[model samples]
Target: MSTSSSSFPSSASSPPSSSSSSPSSVWLVAYMKLKFFTRIRRFLRSKAPHKRNRAASDHHAAEKPRIIDAVVDDDEEEKKDTDKSMVLQKSVKRLHFGTWEEKEMAAEQIQRLARDDVSAKKLIAELGVIPVLVSMVAADESGRRRAAIKALLELANGTYTNKALIVDAGLYTKLPKNIEEIDESTRQEFAELISSLCSLANTQSCPSSYEIISFLISILESKKSSIETKEVSLGALYKLSIVLENAGALISNGVVQTLLMLSLEKQLSEKALAILGHLVVTLMGKKAMEENQMVPERLIEIFTWEEKSKCQELSVYILMILAHQSSTQRAKMARAGIVPVLVKVSLLGSPLAQKRATKLLQWFKDERQAKMGPHSGPQTGRISIGSPCNPREAEEGKKMMKNLVKQSLYKNLEMITQRAASPSSSNLKSFAISTSSKSLPY
Candidate 1:
């Protein structure tokens, strides 16, 4: 070793250089290169699975050729859903009572109520609601069409103009064809509508009344109807009879035989009686009598029937009217057997019925025997009193006479009491008793 203090400089211990691209530059470049390698490793690890899956998918997609088909199917399904929504909207339009453009979405509940044929027609005549609903009913299904027609009849009740339009629409002809084709509920509605039209015609002015009668007669003659339908048909005939009676043309319009037929129905017996009562009154009333003479003998058939409660009831009511009319009518009534029926019903019927019956008997008895000469036998060939009266019949007649007198006395006392209690009350007792005495046949 040299004695000098200067030692050879070790390469590891050399002083650091201050140059720009020295060790620091080399270290920075090495760090950047390391980071790049780490990033590359991570990307390779992540992309391996995705690359394999992509390869498999592309292979399968090529093999099947169904990708376009799948896409088309999805699009078609979406379109079908849209179309279904539109069809539902249209169905609603057909059934609803309002306008379609109102974009009115009706609930299922509302559809049923709005579909009633009768109610629909009735609503059509209302101020703004009619035109829209009528259009719906007319253009809709056959069931709805029928309902609308039925409704029109109800709407026509007080309206003359609507009635004319309904006829012009040919509703009557259109309705009956289906009357034979529809269900019971529909048939009932159909018949009722026809009846209403017939009734409305009667209420119309002049010439239309006769036209209504023709329609009703046609319905009666049709073989397609049931007994019930026939009964209603006959009822319409009787209604026409009333209008004719008012017109003083009851007999002129072939009403007598029609009325007689109506009287024979077990179901319509009461209606028949009412018609007869009206006819009797109409004929006896000063206006009707001034125009016509001779009661239609068709009215006398009621006297000869197998006497049921209803028939007897009618017999009493008619007798009451005839008994109160002039002596000539009373004589005619006696021959009709109205007198004996009155006595029988008085003794055997319900209290109110018996009272009415006995009262008529008493009233009819008041007339002298001479006045009853005309009523002694049947005036019409249609009526035949098959058997003769015996001693028992005469005795029964006498007993009924006694009961009538007693009832008359009791009614008088009641009348006097009522008059004292209420001065406004009529002297019903005195009138009833006196009339009874005057009409007595003895």
Candidate 2:
């Protein structure tokens, strides 16, 4: 068996037979070698399919880029969400427990974050960062206060809940007691924050504290205040005036007088007039405005600005509100020569201005009718025996009284007629200079 096995292996499994001198054997060996090399080359060139790749066995094929991108996007979203949460936690911690400088740094970061993400504003407020920032607003260090105010401003932008939190924090009391003393940039930042928080006037129950309104009024009255700062302060006052309850505070602080002064400035007159309009709806505001020296005259001056239609409309609206139901205000307005301006505005103002001017004109007309009832009487010469006095003297008295009563009205009507034909009638100037305070009954 061993000998047969060895002989079989040598014949079948060993290298090609050494008896290759024969031509047939040599040809067979050459053909076998060529076929073996061909098989080896084919194995090297082709790819083998794995079970996982059986569905797309084509060479170099990969999954679509969109599919990979979608997976990457989901992973990134999760990572971003985690990062946001971590940042929020860190900010809250720093705001609560860190030193003043660290807290200011955190506030700056929160401002940047809040400016970018609306949802983050509410979340950060919920984390109670607002009160901390508000406290920091009163810091002795200007840098720290400014950083806190900037953060509060960003948080208050367009987010009602955040503003509510800020107000609840009593941000008004946090306002610098002496606004004029602060640097311009810091003061402007404070004014801007107040303005932003004041926008909740209509929505929030307690729109702004009295401190806030007074602070804003002080800023407005401050000679040191820049135009931009005053403008922002005016905006805050405007918001506070929206609520009738706030009118008393505004008036008590003499905001009416401040607004009147501002109304004289062409650049600031529009906002000043707008706030006055808001305040004019209340009785206290009306009285304050009526008593103001600049009331109708300042507003009357605003009427000449044909280029300032908005100012005209606001000025007229404020006048109408002031003139409504208050004969004293009407008397004042009449003395201020508001008639000729209203006449011009009624005819040649903006659509809104024209409407308001016409409505105001109607009020004047009604007032006239109320004071001077129908003058027409029986023309008949029939005189009762019971009547006393002479005919010639009576006739003279009748004509003289008629002339006196109709004189003021005639003068106004003449001006209106002349001004209607020509916007800048000389008669208006004459009437304004000549109209008697006692001749017209408001």
Candidate 3:
């Protein structure tokens, strides 16, 4: 077998060659395959550390963005916190600034802040600006005082808690003393502030209510006050009069007399009459109105005038309320000559006025009938004295009927006599006097 393998050729004896023709070719192929595998192994070995380093670098590159983002997020959060802290620090710093102008600006800022409920609460609770504002109000400088008032007014306009803060700060008591020193506009501002405070039902319990009532009354009664001051004061009083406790305070402050005096001024008459209507709601108010004859008297005159439609309407409305107080008030109104005016209003006034006037007229009629006892009616003008009623009441009703009849007759006679003495009679007397004077001159 060794001799045969050597003779034929070891490669040929090993296998039949369909692709390779020689041993060298086969050897070259084997050598190329080995070299390829060796180079592949070398390439793999050489690339291993690089691949690991590249993977690590890629991982670090991805993580770097996340780390930077975390840092950036932290930085932004710090910036936002810093901004909020800066705003708060600036507000506080400006609030206590040394310059009056700066302080006034701060106050104005506070005023603007007080307009919002959350900010107003912050101003009062967190910052405690109310006492600062009150000090500014009592400041010697008018500018500061005015600024402070505006701030306080805004503060009062906020939530009920803010209003309580203002009231507790003694703003109500301090404002009145500053009235004379301030301008008319400032005084009006004060009146508006009081009105705003009094508008809240919760503020009714505050002593400021009565104090404000008295302050406004004083303004109304002061002859030296401006018309604007008086007007705003009347407005404030009107607001305060709606509160039951304030009504007593108003009456005690002699607001009735002040309103009576104010009613005479044509510019102020309508508002004064409007406030008077509110005042007459309470018992003390009604009693005060009754005592002041000018109140009913002026109301009756306004109702009769018929020129000022609003004033006339308000006057009649007030008279209607007063007339309903009691039989005595009805009698007083009748004595004031409001009955005939009411009857005319019922006939010729506006729809609303007519309706109110008609009711009032009916009220008067019913009161008259009530006074005249069960037997009296519209047809029976006189009270029946011999009826089975209270003897004293019958006697009183009889006297009242007699006085009314006498007054009616006297008014009728005066009208007839005026009608008899006409323009023709006056012309004839003037001609005679002129002729006599001419003769004396010649």
Candidate 4:
């Protein structure tokens, strides 16, 4: 085939007798070879376009899905002509009654199918496969547990129903007893899955028991745990803290101190402070936080964080709750030198944080004024703690005070008279003299 290069392929020089020498003919030949690829660019396709995302949702049509993936997918319909049954049925049965190897295989398959197949996810849960897979998570074999966890993670994605199912199956109680016992990879997988499921808390009655809290705390405290794992654990705990009822469980498990310690870490501080913000609202949470030695000072340290504005916001929020109606706690915060920090945050922090800091500053100011009333003033007289002599009696004390005042008045009048004029200016100089009548009654 000869060629030309004017706004066409070099092969366009070939005469218009059907030949594979041009770009257009090349695609046409490939389309002839394939089966269902009838349309040119897979758009405005009359019957079926390219099945771009074969998941539950399809954007080709309106919000209503064009054709179901599991029931009648493009790929399966062409290949499995005789076996028209859905793979979901076979997979559920095998997962339920299959042996060890079969169950693992079934989990892997379910994870794959349920990944993008939202329809298959609901179907798999409807077939009662979730509880079985959850049981597999507790299996002694590491591979079995990992497979089940991965499958459950897939099933829980964007589906509240599957998450509730996993929780109902006691997944909270199924966590590994010790984070150290499991390898790092499995621990991370567990954390990720738990973090996903923890979203179902508070809005519904998902049992966010202490077991889950302790498991997450273990992951957080683990030295071997990755930053990502700790972050996931922190997120789970934060979700659990949303419900006021879970405060006791979280507090009893000592999440307060751990969170207080972690909130100082700049990277992890924001999420950790968020959880503490939720907990600090409750009475018990307030008490627990107040008792921690790191409360106001450590939290005050967060305000100095000019970069992490969110952390500064949450830290100030917790401090406001701590100093709300409690006078003693405010005293402690005042002593911790939170006044300067709050002023800085009120000036520079986020708007919400600024408001909270302003409120706290007002409270501190009010309490300080109340404790020392308008008439109650600072000490002008020097009173030393190591002084051996005692204060004089009331009458003698009054006399001494009067004498001191009179002497001070005399000194002032004498200085004024001297600065008035020289003795040569007789009239004006004499008029400025400190006469006896100039000293008023003490």
Candidate 5:
């Protein structure tokens, strides 16, 4: 009834045995345990290697996308998507037809898009939007014209290749014509658009400039044009001069007389002076000629007309412009009787006219310089206004100054004259015609 005390051996260190502790049996048991464990280890290792490789492959695949796809995605679809965003949404979405505010916002957005130096350019190319913008400029609404002008200004900046296109589109002619019937605000918007276009046209140095100039001149000649339109027209003429200084366009356009007439208008005198001053300096060779250009005669004729019209500012400005011309031109101008008119201008004009007359007298003095050459002969003095008097000769000076001041050319001339005769007259030495040969510094 006794049981044998047997214990199961631990796997870590025990040897396998078939019978009781026999060496062979122990060896065999150990070998069997070893073989079983080796088989199990091989099975686990095989499966482990496959799992480890699969995991590594998956991890590498995920990590590989981060590097390779980064550049490829950027170079492919994503790049195109970035460009497509710039394409102007040409279809009139619901926003285009929304409430007044919404419509305004839409127009503003389009303008902002067109005004953006980068986006406008891309959108213009992508959406073919120039026609749309021209239509906007032609719109009856002032807000629309303002927005369209901004857009067109951006589009037209430094782009001369489109000048013919713009003109051919009849944008300029139509805008000015329509501006006449519009409200004042709308007219101003049109003016702004014209000014911007002029700025662009002035900078264009190509041969085709004459065409634009011609169009502007036509607009200027429109007798039905409003004063605002005329202002824009004259401004455009000034810009046209910048383009045509050497192009011989202004002379051919016969604009000098138009400018001369404009100068005579009391209301338009300032603007006319601005245009003539630039023309005097820029279009010197193009002055009226007996053969090719008769600009000198045309200009002198304006003085004659001014003298008749009693426009002293006009006379002074005309004289100033003549004074800047060549010696021959000045002599012709003087011979045309511009000098006496200016001398009268200096004497009769108010302080403003007198100041300009002072400069005109200075130009006359330079004209005398050109006349003082050794080969020059003693020319007959200008006697149209009575005997010319010299400095320091009191009685004769009194007579001549009287003749000069008697014209009373300006609206404010009487005020200036009274101011000159006041007890404080000594402070007004500039108004005095001194008898010294150098009495007039000019």
Candidate 6:
């Protein structure tokens, strides 16, 4: 009612102020309004139906409880493993049942499992299958006995722990007894088991070295034993010879003579030679071989045999050891004509054989030079002791050589006689006497 005829302007219609009247200002205002409206529209558009639904679902999920099934899956997996272990355990337990069919089936399963080291260890450790296997070794049924022996062999082949388990289960004692009456096939398996057990060093489950050696010797000496039986026995002896104590036992049990005889057989010579080589590492073994008298001769003969390249190499090595032991042993080797064979081997043998042969040749050369004096030249051929010498010194040298030969011969005779007179030599007296007579100096 008090208006003086003036009107207020609305925003849409306002115009013509000094700043707003310019074209640039009008455009700026229009742009600002358009930009603000555009931003509002974009904000409304960004809250889409699908995006809102996803957010609502995520919020609902977070608000709700999560029931984890991971533990359930892990438990299921563990249960499966437990079930498998239980099955294995049940199968192993069946081995001890009194029924023949059950025992045989259990043994067959064990044989299959024993081939795997993991399964073998499980059978022995987790399942305690060794005692059952030992009992099966004593079973009167041949098939069960063989199956048990085979299973044990597989188990023993795995680890030292498995071998000790077998031993603790009385396999060592029971195996020897089983070997007594079993057929050749079963005997071979028993022998193999013994060999495998003995291969483990310092195992209490192994048969005593003496018992093992005696058993092997008897097998080797048995004409009724199959070649495979004797071979495995020889292999066991070879393994046993690695122990120093066993070396003494092997010799004391007359293993050397058996080995020496076996060394001549075409099929067994390599193993026999390898065993002999090991045995001679000990002082007692060397003495035993030397006392046997035929050992060196056989070795020399093997070295010269045309088809025995491996045996020849071993023989050369063993002879080198024997020669290095003493001058007398070297002289004995020389008397056996080993020196010439060594020279031949040096010239024509394999590289390894040639190397060993050269060393031995040099050793004999040094030995000869020492014996013949420093000025002595190498001998080209045999010299006659009766040949006259022109110079006095030459004559003295010849006489000295003759005396050395006679002394060597006498020394050899003395050794033979002494060996013959010993009680142990009673069995070998005729052989020693004949050897001495043949070696006598005319």
Off by over 4 Å in 5: 1-127, 131-191, 201-208, 243-247, 282-286, 289-341, 344-442
Instruction: Tell me which of candidates 3 and 6 scores higher on lDDT.
Output: 6
Question: Deviation in angstroms for 29 in model 5?
Answer: 86
The local distance difference test score of each candidate is 0.47, 0.73, 0.61, 0.70, 0.49, 0.65
Best by lDDT: 2
Error of 5 at 326 (Å): 6.9
* Per-residue error (Å), model 2, residue 164: 1.8
CA lDDT of 207 in candidate 1? 30
Summarize candidate 2's per-residue lDDT along 123-231 as a digit string, tens digits: 6786668889999988999999899999999999998778888888888777778876799899899888878877888775455467887888888888888899998
- Model 1 residue 429 lDDT score: 29
Instruction: For candidate 6, write residues 23-78 as lDDT tens digits.
Output: 88876655544453343234323322243334444554543333134334545655
TM-score of each: 0.43, 0.69, 0.58, 0.66, 0.43, 0.63
**In model 3, which runs have C-alpha deviations exceeding 4 angstroms?**
1-88, 97-102, 112-125, 202-209, 223-231, 265-270, 305-310, 325-332, 363-442
TM-score result, candidate 2: 0.69
* Model 6: residue 413 alpha-carbon error in angstroms: 28
Error of 4 at 105 (Å): 1.7
* Cα-based lDDT at residue 229, candidate 2: 91
Steric clash pairs (candidate 4): none
Cα lDDT tens digits for candidate 1, 129-205: 23333443333355654545444545666555555556555554343332344454544445565566665545543
Residue 432 lDDT, candidate 3, scale 0-100: 18
Per-residue C-alpha lDDT of model 3 across residues 263-367, encoded as one tens digit per residue:
878889999988776666566776788778686777777776566777876777666656554677777777778767776775666555665666676666656
RMSD of each: 31.2, 24.5, 32.3, 21.3, 27.2, 30.1
